[model samples]
Target chain A: MMSKIVRTMASFLILFVLIYGLYIIMHGHSTPGGGFQGGAVVASGVALLIVAFGSHSIHRSLLERRLSILISIGLLIFIGLAFGGMAKTFFYNFLVGSPIFGHIPPSGPNPGEMSSGGVIPIMDIGVGLNVAGGLSAILLVMALATTVMEVEE
Target chain B: MRKIAIAVSLSIFIGFLIATAFLIHPFGYPPSEMDDYIIENTQSETGANNAVTAVIFDYRGFDTLGEATILFTAVTGVVMLFRAKKKREK
Candidate 1:
């Protein structure tokens, strides 16, 4: 069993890393790291939990079915945004007129936003969710496959 | 028993080593010119900041559509393989 200090450190580290990674994803359009990188970091946090405890422990929180659903939902969000927006015009910027301070309006003609960048944030969020779900799915499935115990009858 | 354990572990380790050493590219390298072109062009067309997604979903949607079909084909192959294995085991 881990000592109190170690447990506290683990808890603190988990929160810090996950939130930091989320910050990276949120500011991805304006900053260095994007959705994939941030998403991988988020997965790393989940992996850290698996490494510290066992697989069944993590499963208590993020189940396999939930992870699969999240992945599908993320992909659907992106697809829905695409076709739904495309319905308006061929290559039309769906977020053209949205309001923002640092960036120009998203709807007009020019692309790239401080905020005017269009649906990139929504896309980033979708990709982030997709990746988080995917990584968790792989981890959860592997955990389930290996969670057997040998019994002597 | 130790010998059996060692041999099994060794073989699995060796398999992983071979796969990692050769299956993945020899070394990491910078993106090629084609990649650079897609990066600039897709971001331009899709108004999507992520050039990769733009290319996959918009710029070359047909290509991705074909790739998805190929993935479905592979899944079919895997199911067939599993059925054959079950039949043999039974």
Candidate 2:
């Protein structure tokens, strides 16, 4: 556990980090940041919480099983979306003309549209979830291992 | 003799690195026709304003799949290793 001030600050800051990360992931189709980058940002926030309140406490809430399930779901969503376009070809942008996320932006510089990018934003979300879960699981396990080592010592 | 050999190899490696650095294409100006095509048609074809995202998620999705698989395997391996350790302790 950390000082009460540190814990309070971490709890407060995590919300902003999470929102920023989601923004990056959702706007990936029209922005510089993408799934991997945004996921890393969110994982960093999880790391902050883990550091503020020891891994054991954090583990109680963010279980390994839950993270694994999250990863699996993300992977399934990504692959499912990919297969959705199999009628034309694998990984086709089938949603481009559909009602969902189907608006095509005018060519050249523009403000960009949220309802654009077809399957790209969805894929970004999937990949972001997968990355966030995987990285958090890794950090949690590593922290737990360190605590175990301390106990052994 | 070993020290002399190490020095020769290190010099040779450094020389190769320098040669490659000098010989490589200028920054951001590679001679590839595919880049032009992607840049021109990415908006129309993929409907993504970000060309980089379009390329990764659409033009080269198989590679992303491979990357995700690698991450999954790594996480599974780590979790299994730690779980086994915990079991041994109990």
* RMSD to native, candidate 1: 9.6
What residue runs in model 1 are displaced by over 4 Å at the alpha carbon?
A1-6, A88-92, A97-113, A147-153, B1-90
In the range A19-105, model 1's lDDT, one tens digit per residue, is 988887776654466556777788888877776666666778877668667766766666666665676753344664545422332
| Clashing pairs for predicted structure model 2, backbone only | none
lDDT of model 1 at residue A30?
Answer: 47
TM-scores across all candidates? 0.59, 0.94
Residue pairs clashing, model 1: A96-A106, A96-A107, A97-A107, A113-A117
lDDT by residue (B1-90, candidate 2, tens digit) is 999999999999999999998899988788989988999988888888899999999999999999999999999999999999999998
Tens-digit per-residue lDDT, A18-50, candidate 2? 999999998898989889989899999999999
Q: Give the distance in Å from residue A86's predicted Cα in candidate 1 to where it truly belongs.
A: 1.5
Model 2, C-alpha of A123: deviation from truth (Å) = 0.6
| lDDT: worst 10-residue window of model 1 chain A | A144-153
List, residue by residue over B1-90, the lDDT tens digit for candidate 1: 999999999999999999888877558775489887765554444445555555544555445335434433443454355446546744
Highest TM-score: which candidate? 2
